[model samples]
Structure formats: structure tokens, C-alpha cells
Target chain A: TQLLEQSPQFLSIQEGENLTVYCNSSSVFSSLQWYRQEPGEGPVLLVTVVTGGEVKKLKRLTFQFGDARKDSSLHITAAQPGDTGLYLCALGGNEKLTFGTGTRLTIIP
Target chain B: DVKVTQSSRYLVKRTGEKVFLECVQDMDHENMFWYRQDPGLGLRLIYFSYDVKMKEKGDIPEGYSVSREKKERFSLILESASTNQTSMYLCASWGQNNYGYTFGSGTRLTVV
Candidate 1:
């Protein structure tokens, strides 16, 4: 229902570059999850943030939730080829019901 | 490691044929879900089962049905396959230990 909107539908950058993707919504969210899906595989949940203004880090990846809880951002530093995948943001409504328009990132070697 | 397994990696079937996609999870999770993914439109939930014989409709449940006879296995049945139904289907289960849904490799189905 267009609840979540992700920026940069497609992004390609050189290896070792830094990048950030955004997921925004006008409706407030109770909790949000970030997932990475490689080609030919189901998406894997990277992290979940429940509190407003919360931040979580996984290796070179950094995730932040907005203070209003209506948006989130994912930043990657010194990205590698292995960082290439589609990043999706999902809202935990009734039961993790909705997904954002994904950002497909490609880190070129 | 705990796993969610889908029966077929790929399938090609004639239009109007009945199709069955099977999924099983070994984690003994209490919840299981089915989702179909497409190119631009992300993953859309088709159905989910919370417990044995307890099923719930998701965002896009039209033209689809699910059966969970046991705690481990869940099935998605297409009463009559159509070209529109050709998409990558995925199965997932939620576990308290895992803290998130673990997905199957996915089944890419084609209708001719």
C-alpha cells in the first residue's frame, strides 16, 4: 500500500566507496527491519530496530532509525563486492506485513 | 543448522494445471509464511500459518490457498495455475531463538 518508500531504486558504486540508502514513510512505525537479498536467494534479515533514534551496526554496515520512527537509513562504509544485493525495509505491522521499494546496490570491483 | 526447505527449486507447468509447492521447517517454529517476489514489486505475503490448522490471509491472498496439517510442513496450492502466478515463491518460518524469519532458497515457477 506504499507505506514504505526507499530511495535510489538502483545504485552502483566502486569498491571501497561509502553509500547510504533511505527508507521513509509518513506513517509512524512500531518497529522496522532491514533485509539483504542476493540474486537467486531469499532475503536475509540484517537487523531490526525498535526504538526511535536507535542505531545498530553489523560489520561495515550501519543502520539508524529516525526519532519519529517513520524513517530509517542504512549506511555502508568501504563497501566490498560482497555488499551487492537488494536492500529492503519492512514494517512490523500485524506481522512484518509491508516492504519498501528496494534499493539494489552493486559494488563494482 | 536450522533450515527451511522448499521442495522444488524450479517448476514449469501448463496453464490451468493444479500446482502444489511444499515447504518444511526443522526449527519447530510456531509461525510460517509464504511470499511471492517479483522484479520491481518486493516480496508480497500470500498466506501465513500460526499453528497447526490455523491459517491467516496476508496482503495478497487472492487465487491462493495454504494447508498446514502438521507443525513442520506447510503447502501452497494453486488450484489452477496461470501465467500471472509465475513468480519466485518463498517459504519462511519464525523462531524465538532465531529472532527472525528464516527463508527457503525459493522456488521459481513458470506457467506456459
Candidate 2:
């Protein structure tokens, strides 16, 4: 089975600070997606990257797909309290998508 | 926009009782998926259906079964609910070629 390992399982940061979370895997995927979820809710898709070395920006968040298609990263610039949530990365292949362990982020006000 | 709707936000059931979780999608997506989310395990796929009357077992499908008799609705059934089945259940759907999934609000099932 293919697995995606995420770094810094938990992150605590102050507002306005910049933070980055990484997702790495040994298996290559056709596409990758990033999602942010709040308590009691399902994850909301933040962005989807299909090309290797592609970068997509959504407001204050930047998502980058690694050149090898086996890794990805999410960076938050000037984080805010609203950004505190569970961040997850998912890989899609063969009509199935697998999710990463996830990174729980807390932005202290 | 794609909308995936789950039947329940929270449910409590006794052990050995039969439980059913319902999910519906409005986008007419060809693929629908059911997953259970745990604290540290992230989201583990329980079952998925590619088309009407078609279902496939995912990574973890030991105690779960799914029914997708129609394109827009999918149901997850627990033959006999157990304490270990308590978790947040999520439903998602997308087109055949698209990998981006639109998820429902999720159902938190507690088996006591």
C-alpha cells in the first residue's frame, strides 16, 4: 500500500508567523490535493496540483507539488487564527485517493 | 459546485445493533466514496463505488458494507455495530476523471 507521511504532526504558531508543512511518500501519484478541516466537519479542498513542480496560491496559502510527484508542501504566509485547523494532503491514483496522516495547526492570537 | 450530503451529524447506537449511514451527491459524479476518520489514522477508505450497482472495498472494509443502487445516493451499512466502529464517517464524490473530492459534513457515530 502507498503511504504519505506528513511532518510536524502538530504545529503551534503565533499569528502573522509563516509555517510550512511537508508531505512525503515513496510512491508517485498522478495528482495531489490539499485540504483543511475544522472540528465536526469534513475536510474542504484547498487546492489540487496535477503537474510536477507546480505551485498554486490561494490567498495566503501556497501549495507546491514536488518535481518527483512523490512529495508536496503547504506554506502559509502571515498565518491567522482562522488558519488553525487540520491540514491534510492526498494522492490520487488508479481511481483511488489516499490521504496523509495530517498536521493539526494552531495559531495563537 | 458539488455538494455531498451525509444523513447524520451525530448518532449513538448500542453494540450489535444494525447501523446505516446515508450519503448523497448532487453533482451526478460517477464515483462515490465512504471513509472513516480517526484521531491519528487520518482518513481511511472503507468503500467506494464507481457506478450504480458497483462497489469496491477500500483499505479498511472488514466490518463495513456499502450499497450504491443509484448514481446519486450511497449507503454504508454496519452489519453489527461495535465499539471499535465509533468514528467520524465521511462521504465524498467526484467525476470519473477528476480526482478532487467534494466531501460531506461527516457523521460521528458512537457505538456503546
DockQ for every model comes to: 0.63, 0.75
Best by lDDT: 2
Model 2 TM-score relative to the real fold: 0.97
Q: What is the TM-score of chain B alone in each candidate?
A: 0.98, 0.96
A26-69, model 2: which lDDT tens digit per residue? 78888888999998889998989999999999999999999999
Clashing pairs in 2: none
Candidate 1's C-alpha runs over 4 A off are none
Return the TM-score for candidate 1, rounded to 2 decimals.
0.96
lDDT of 2 at B72: 99
**TM-score of predicted structure 1, chain A:** 0.95
Chain B TM-score, structure 2: 0.96
List of clashing residue pairs for candidate 1: none
Each model's C-alpha lDDT? Answer: 0.91, 0.93
The worst-scoring run of ten residues by lDDT in candidate 1 chain B lies at B94-103
lDDT of 1 by residue, A24-99 (tens): 9879988888999999888898998899999999999999999999999999999999999999998864344578
Candidate 1 structure lDDT: 0.91
RMSD (Cα, Å) for all candidates, in order, is 1.3, 1.2
Clashes of 2: 0
Please state the CAPRI-style docking class of candidate 1: medium
